[model samples]
Target: MTNTENQARPIFPFTAIIGQEEMKLALILNVIDPKIGGVMIMGDRGTGKSTTIRAIADLLPEIEVVADDLFNSHVSDYDLMSDFVKNQINRGKELLTKWIKVPMVDLPLGATEDRLCGTIDIEKALSEGVKTFEPGLLAKANRGILYVDEVNLLDDHLVDILLDSSASGWNTVEREGISIRHPSRFVLVGSGNPEEGELRPQLLDRFGMHAEIRTVKEPSLRVRIVEQRSDFDKNPEACIDKFREQQIKLKENILLAQSKLPNVIIDYSLRVKISEICSILNVDGLRGDIVTNRAAKAFAAYQGREEVTLNDIKTIITLCLRHRLRKDPLDTIDSGSKVDRVVGEVIGDV
Candidate 1:
């Protein structure tokens, strides 16, 4: 797409999304620290799960990439490039750069492995007797967002591919006498209705946060949602214009949080609390401990604070570790409430 077309594409305003604050905050925090990993959103249909994700992507800042590069390789990703790309950079040639929107790539349910991870150029191989690597969705998604709608319905093998790529930050494609690797760093956002099916445990563990959303219950809020959506459907451009200022402020806030993230401090006591809470809840692996710490730090940065606070952890505990809980048949409490109770017992109320 041309830059002009990209800029002109209308998106629902992030600030105007009626509710689903948990999902919105999770997305914002992921943008701040992709290292915190990605989020899994389980909710009812038409609860704005996909809409909120797209809105968050729309508000993200543009990315800088090597102009004309097939893999959307940024300067930092130079080391992970294919030998062909590396050769171009090795010569005394200045690489041109271009600014593009942060990719929000959809991983459709039926996508083939070759299409998802790219494949060999069969025609080029036949005609030129040379092997060339074709890029895939993962390559395009580098330094951006990879969204999977109805993620629970995705095939197990494809789920494994996503997990592998997410864990290693690399997507390796090996075909007939050809292999290539590229940076595949991205915030993996998956949304699905729980009533459809349960996610695989391994894949669930990979996600940094989990949030469940529901339909709006308040009568007034529901009316407002209807009105705003109707207005946007009537004139998308006008709705975008109306929320332009708030969107800009939110974008600026994210940029500022990113800059501030490195300096945000996590005190030892908070670290102890994170571990203690995870231990109390019997969550497996250190992923819970690590993600909670990173999330709290990001929350501090988002709030323009230099140090982590108990409140930061309190606000984010459910998002960070709810999906990590093991089910107990005897315990009737929902996982979210269990997390709250455990957190309260371990750390007291913030």
Candidate 2:
């Protein structure tokens, strides 16, 4: 589908989502600070994981991009622009820009490596002496969200490629000595049912936060969710209209959070304590510490605060550190509970 058509598609309102607050918060914080890395959501099937993701993407504010740019090259930021865009700027060419909804590229479970990463046409290069490059899902996902459903089943090599590009904020394609590179920065979101399988520890640790969701057990809440879905299915437009005000406020809050994230700071003592928890838990690397700090700051910014609070860290600590803990086949305690126990020991009833 065309970009316009994709943006125009009706999506369930983010504010209207009834449960899965942890998953929603993780997503919002990532949008506020992409530096937090991204979120990995694990839950039961039909628990609204995909719906919640789509809602957040729909709720995001539009961004300006170079007109007709395949990579959605940032209008003014040099780091976010493609090499072609940079060359244009160097030549003093005026850039035409347009505002568009944030792209949300879904990665199919069976996608080939070449489809995930753009391919260079070697035959065209030899025939015409000009490299023909075709941008793939990674290019479309730049400056937006790249969501992978059933991620536990994705190939390990593909997961490695995604993590590498996510870390480097760029994708490079080379074929027959022809090479192309472009910005591929995006918030990588992956969701899956735990019953199928678990992602390898190393790959899971790459995600900034891990949100665990479950099917709603409360009958009343379940009924409400069902009713809401039925309402939307009956008349999507009217249902969206009902939550229009709330959606607007949420969108505004996200935009403000993004603007305020850079100024949000965590106290030195708190930083020390965060690392202490990671160290005590034997978390493999400094990623747990770094992501926790960033997630805490993003949480504070989302709350309209300029300084990180102990409460903010307490709220998101589990999401940041749970998946990073070394799993013991013998230990039955939950990873999230283990992280929380460490937080209590280190932060002391905060």
Candidate 3:
């Protein structure tokens, strides 16, 4: 199939969809701050996982990027490599520029190991190529999002490669008689059903937060959803007009949240409360605490608040750290209940 054929496939818009407010909020939170690592949406198939992500790709504001920079590296960045690009840029080079909304690049399950990292051009090298470098999925995903559907089913080696690249912000390739390394930094987004299989603990830990998305059950809401989806399928132009107003509102909310994140402060007592809560529940590592704190601030920012209160922390603690906590076979406290217990005690203490 041609690239034209592939691009013709329809994408669902984020704001046009109905219900699933929690999932929408979580995704928006990560978008406001990519430092949230990325989000993991775990649930049954056909739950609009891919749809929501693709919609977000379209909804995001266009980012300003460097001129012809591999990895779509941001123009705002200094300290770039590429002696050629760097020298030209330093010499006061103006850009051949275009604005692009963030790309949501997919990683298909069937992708080969070499295809992902890229391979050496043997024919080109032997001819006039002089070992010409080619781009890979990681290259396309930079300054954007790398989405893996059914991520739990991905090959072990591929999972390892992604985890390493995610941590270091670059992928190193030394294969096929060539040594190539490039920046591949991105927000790693993955969605899968937990029943099919579990992602490796190490890979799972890379995700900053996890959220559950279930099918909406309201009859009126469900009917509206189907009608809107049908309308979108028929005359996307009409559906777009109906949804764009909501989209603009959401986009404004996201921008407000981002701007508010820097000034939103968490009290010291609340910090101790969070640490104590995570400790009581035996959550592993410091990332949980850090993410919970940030999420609380983001939540407050979303609410147009200037500071994070204990209530804000309570609401976000589970959303942030629940996935990272260890489960007990003997004890019956589920992640949600565990969070509630901790929140209650912490609030009492504070």
Candidate 4:
């Protein structure tokens, strides 16, 4: 397809999406601060979970990369480049650059480990008497979004690989006496229906924030969703054009938030409050504390504020701590409610 045609293929605008406010907010906050880790969404089907995620691609700003770099290495990521690429640069060749969309790759449920983590180029090694490496989904996902639609259904081994790469920001493959390591940093967004199965706790905790999405229950809201979606389906281009201005503005806001994040400050009192809430919830580790701080700061930045506030903490606490709660077999309530109750008890409900 022509570039124009490709660009013209309509996607539901991020601003035009109906309900699921928590899911949308979680995504936006992650864009503002990817270090908050990634978001896991569990809810009923047809709640616009994947639709909301796909719409986010329209809002992403383009990134600068070294031209022809297979790994999408940024100018600042030179040290992380593979040896051959580094050697070429060391020979005084002027590095070429290009502007491309930040990658947003979908990891399929049936994907193999080799495809997910890259494999050795066996054919080339055997035919040419030279070793070569092939990049995979993890490579394509570098500095981008790696989305898993049915994350709960992923195999245990792939889950472990994702967890390792996520924690370390690198994917290493060692086979046939060749070891290759490359940057694999990306915001991981996963969605699944709880009715299918429960996500493993170890994998669950890997997500920085968790949001529960529900089908729109209000008739008025439901009607609005149907109408907007109908308009888009009838004439996608026109619908997209109508929201073009708002989409551009959102993109600009995200860029501004990113630039302002370094200046957004977190104070000692908020830190203590985060620790206290986590402690009250009996959270297992400091991940809860760290994600809470990062998410609140990102929210503050997104709202053009200079510092994190108690309200910021309250706004994001549920998402940060909900999934981290230790399972209580005797407790009948959900983790989200438990988190809210603890927050209300500890911080007095901003």
Instruction: Give the top-scoring candidate (TM-score).
Output: 2
Query: Residue-wise lDDT of candidate 3 within 1-350, one digit each (tens)?
Result: 88867774555779877777666777887787777777778887777888888888788778776668766765656432333456667899876656787878899999887777777777888888587567688777877888999988999798778767766777777866677777777778888987787676656766878787777777898789788878888987777787788888888888888888899888898898889888887887887888888788888898899888887876667777766764442332133776777678767544
Tell me how candidate 1 scores on lDDT.
0.86
Name the better of 1 and 2 by TM-score. 2
**Model 4 regions more than 4 Å off:** 1-8, 78-84, 328-335
- lDDT for every model? 0.86, 0.90, 0.76, 0.86
> How do all models score by TM-score?
0.94, 0.95, 0.88, 0.94
- 2 versus 4: better lDDT goes to: 2
* Root-mean-square deviation of every model: 2.6, 2.5, 3.3, 2.2
- Misplaced by over 4 Å in model 3 are 1-10, 79-84, 176-179, 327-335, 348-350
Steric overlap count per candidate: 0, 0, 0, 0
Candidate 2 per-residue lDDT, tens place, 1-350, comes to: 78867665689999999989999999999999887889999998999999999999999989999996889999889879999999999999999999999999999999999999988766877889887888999999999999999998999999999988888899999865768899999999999987788888888889999999999999999999999999999999999999999999999998898889888889999899899999999998799999999999999999999998889989999999888874653332255988888788888875
State the weakest 10-residue window (summed lDDT) of model 1. Answer: 326-335
Tens digits of per-residue lDDT, candidate 1, 1-350, equal 78877675677899999888899999999999988889999888888887888999989989888887887777556644545567777885677888999989999888989888999888998999988887889998888899999988999788888877876788888898777878888899998887787776667878889988889999999999999999999999899999999999999999999999999999998899899999988898999999999999999999999999999999998999888884542322255988899888988965
Error of 3 at 24 (Å): 1.2
- Taking all chains together, the TM-score of candidate 1 against the true structure is 0.94
Candidate 2 clashing pairs, residues 3+ apart or interchain:
none
lDDT of 3: 0.76
Which ten-residue region of model 2 has the weakest summed lDDT? 326-335
